[model samples]
Target: MVISLFFILPIVSIIREIGYLITSKIFGAKKSKITIGSGPKLFHLSVFEVRKYYFAYSWCSYDSLRNESKLAHIIIYASPILSNLLIALLINGLLAYELLGLPNFWNKFVFYSFYFVLFDALPIYYPDGQPSNGRVIYNLLRYGRKSDFERNDPQIDIKKTDEK
Candidate 1:
């Protein structure tokens, strides 16, 4: 319990700091740059990682709301740190519940492990209403948008990629 906090705290801090920098230096002077007068979004991005494939960025504004429905090449990239934090906290919660002190800790371990795995299986862009199959497969599995069947299990080996 005590030791776990030690690890998670620093990571949280570092991730936040990095997020600030990236959103500033990288995201640059854009239309959807955080908030100024009105304040942040209602259910907007807190943190996301997008498995490293969500670097492309594009923004879209809505007619009804003041906020723009901005979607990145990868939705997960919207808030990487927050995503990591959620995963970490879930892990800690599982640990505290299942392994604070128990003899047969494996039962809890296996059970909690699925939470991690299944959450991961949410498919990078496969959240709820994803428009395209941009790594995250939650597109077709949603309600509003139709799915784009564009997936390719590219054939490449370690030695081949390393040459570049």
Candidate 2:
């Protein structure tokens, strides 16, 4: 249980971020930072940062949020989910074909990878008042205001987004 909570979860997050990074680059967005953990910085690698927790969360920063098209924002926000879902499907496909015989741990990791896509993408606050990706997207579509979908000031809810 501990291993699943700490190791597998972070791995899943990192994998998802890699997908976002790739998609962001493809879209010609400016990359600012990619953090692989929470807490104090332990080291740095160009645009990447490694922190103490290293397993708590993975965050990606980009300069592509302002004034972009609604489709672009949706792609960026959904990149992680799309990426993880693809990986999960591919791995399961291979497993079904018997082309790969991964360990039980890896099998479980694949399942968790798919699970976290739904979990993280759910539209709910994370105890810090920050909205999830789903919420942000929801607000963007619900309010019918493209200009309100800023990354820094995401439309977490309809009431808040409608104010401005």
Q: lDDT winner among the candidates?
A: 2
Question: Candidate 2 residues 8-80, lDDT tens each?
Answer: 8888887888877876776777756688877688999987788888887677878764436667767777888
TM-score per prediction, in order, is 0.24, 0.78
> Can you write out model 1's per-residue Cα lDDT over 19-136, one digit (the tens) per residue?
4335443434243222111212233453322212121221221112232223431233333434444555665676657744552343343343344334434445333323222233
Candidate 1's error at 76, in angstroms? 6.8
lDDT of 1 at 52: 20
- The predictions' CA RMSDs to the true structure, in order, are 16.1, 4.7
Cα-based lDDT at residue 34, candidate 2: 80
Candidate 2: 10-residue stretch with minimal lDDT: 153-162
Query: Against the hidden true structure, what lDDT does model 2 obtain?
Result: 0.72
